[model samples]
Target: MPNDKGRRRRFGSVRKLPSGRFQARYRGPDGLMRTADNTFATQTDADRWLVKQEAKILDGDWTNPDVKIAFGDFAEDWFKDRDYAATTRERNAVVLNRFILPTFSDLPLREITTPQVRRWRTDLIEAGVGAASVAKAYQVLRAILHTAVDDGLIERNPCRIKGAGSVTHTERPFLSVPEVYRLADAVPPHCRALILLAAFCALRFGELAALQRHDIDLEAHTVSVRRAYAETRAEGLIVKAPKSAAGVRTVAFPASLAEELAHHLAEYADAGRTGLVFVGARGGVMRRNNFRRIWLRALAATGLGDVHFHDLRHTGNTLAATGGASTRELMHRMGHSSVRAALIYQHLVNGRDHVIADYVDGQIRKVKRPPHGPSGT
Candidate 1:
């Protein structure tokens, strides 16, 4: 007998079945100690599993030995623990209810197989959902299954199965410098500064609309992006932290743009100390639909065709990258969390080879090749 307090206790025991396979037996979650039999290459392998189980129990994160819950019920439990924005929660709920739950809802998670998930994906494609949307639906399913695995409700995630078709990534459309200037000139006088900031500073539309007098420093020529405004189904407009830590940064503006911002502040920013820098005619947050209407009308006025408001931010990134800004500088200015995203903006600018060649030529002319040691003396 082993001391329960001082020594590691051995389970009910390993026994050889009639087929000559060794099986390890252990108590399960039902308060009834049960034995799980499996074939192991050696006794050492069985011992290793016992050690792992002990460690999991000591850490108080042990998963149940058996999984038996329906995936739909488990998903509800998983959703209860997640803290997400109202819109994000709604979007996830829609994906789960419409696409994911119907197939896997009543089935026990432990019984789900890769074949079933593949069939579900095939049905989604046949129903006219794009590959990208299907991929997103797959991601939602994967996340839910991952949570179930973590909680010991399942042994592995079936959604990890491969062979999903390539997901089409949407590229952001950007405007040329000339197009940017034309847009700036065509927008309503009151909205021109906002549009210019979006194109020149790479500010997101939400961040641009959330700007307050206190967030801009005219003397420093910088705008602090601390908050953003987003509309939710339940909440019309709500202010939230800039999406990530990188987003909560102070980005510098061109001196000329800073001057324009100063003038706009003086003319339109309300007498209230905390007034919004850009607002609706009724002194509320600017809505996306209204801004899109204004942008389309401005594009027509400028003789430009079919430009989305988001292109202004892309135009800003392209201008910075093409004007000899380093990747680090672009990342800082654009509030991008990864170098890859910064590179995408840099690649869109074009004509970098010519710029690099001119720089190399200038450097070569300045070098004096070791003072030309006289005729190889």
Candidate 2:
């Protein structure tokens, strides 16, 4: 049969419609002729479209053009089908509602383009969002789009901006040994061991908050971390397993702190074996906001400037590095799943290196004076 160009065509046909627009049609793998989604301005344009459709079908990348899936529906299903912890679920939902969905929710999966992704990230940064928050939002968006690509809803993911999802880590402060103890003493009598354990044991605030009388072994000088309390405004405190398997291991504290730990439990802890090790002023479950008030007062009393509760754990990790703890040991102590974070602490092992250098220098001096040194006896 003659094509709309008034010539014989090989495998597909292009015809000029009554409206004078060129329509492309080709036999799909199902042996049914499929029309292009959009009409072209010219017959050659329609022919080019038909060639692409044939290429896609032959390449096994054929997708039904009739099915139009919106991004919002797909992304919500993606979020629901996964097995996420309660805290992670809450965070993903927040990220979707606040950052991801507002931009691409109603759009078709195939319609999301690289330019749109780049512009969306730029708008977020221009809108005064923090770099870390924007990075998190970008990561969530990239993850959802990646699922779309894998599902064959989109040919490729649109989130391809280099370094768009990475945030530079700012250095956080860690207190010295004396500073940790001073801050501990500045807090209430009940909170002394809290400070000591935080700075020495390297337990996260969440892990520390979830600690119970049974989790501590004064005799072993070890604290078992099994669960952690993850709290969000939408969801109150959620007791969940540690984020990683490494987080579930036991951490040994300095033997010197065992007495203080025992004393804290005896004097202030709840009456039962499973009682919360750290409780609120009224002996109820402790929340971060409530404990933060105490932390601030202690900081003020010690004249320490703006210390976050998390910094105590960082301090402990630095101290571990100073003791020449290996990367694996730091990972275990920090409850980190990877050596990257542990390596940061190793880089901060200034004290141990100095001691080694001094010891080596002393040994060298003791080695029969280097070939007629002027000041040597």
What TM-score against the true fold does each predicted structure earn?
A: 0.73, 0.80
Off by over 4 Å in 2: 1-25, 30-32, 35-60, 338-377
Q: Report the C-alpha lDDT of model 2 over 1-377, residue by residue, as the tens digit.
A: 24455444686888878787887778877778888879998888887887877787788878886678998999889988978888788887887899889989999888889999999999999999899889999998899889888777788899999998899988999887768867876888767778877888788888887899999987766788889988877778889888886687666666556667777888878878899998878887777888889998888888999789999989887777766666666776777876444443453354433332233233324433332112211
lDDT of 1 by residue, 1-377 (tens): 22212223465355544564555656644556655545665555656766665576667656664547888898888877778766677777888898888888999888888888889999999999878778878988888888877876666888865746357667867876556656866776668678878877788999999988998887866688888888877777889886666677666665455556766787767656678899876666788878888888888898777677888888777767766767766676677766444443353256442343233223323432222111211
RMSD from true fold, candidate 1: 12.3
Whole-model lDDT, model 1: 0.70
- What clash count goes with each model? 0, 0
Q: Give Cα distance to truth, residue 228, candidate 2, Å.
A: 1.2
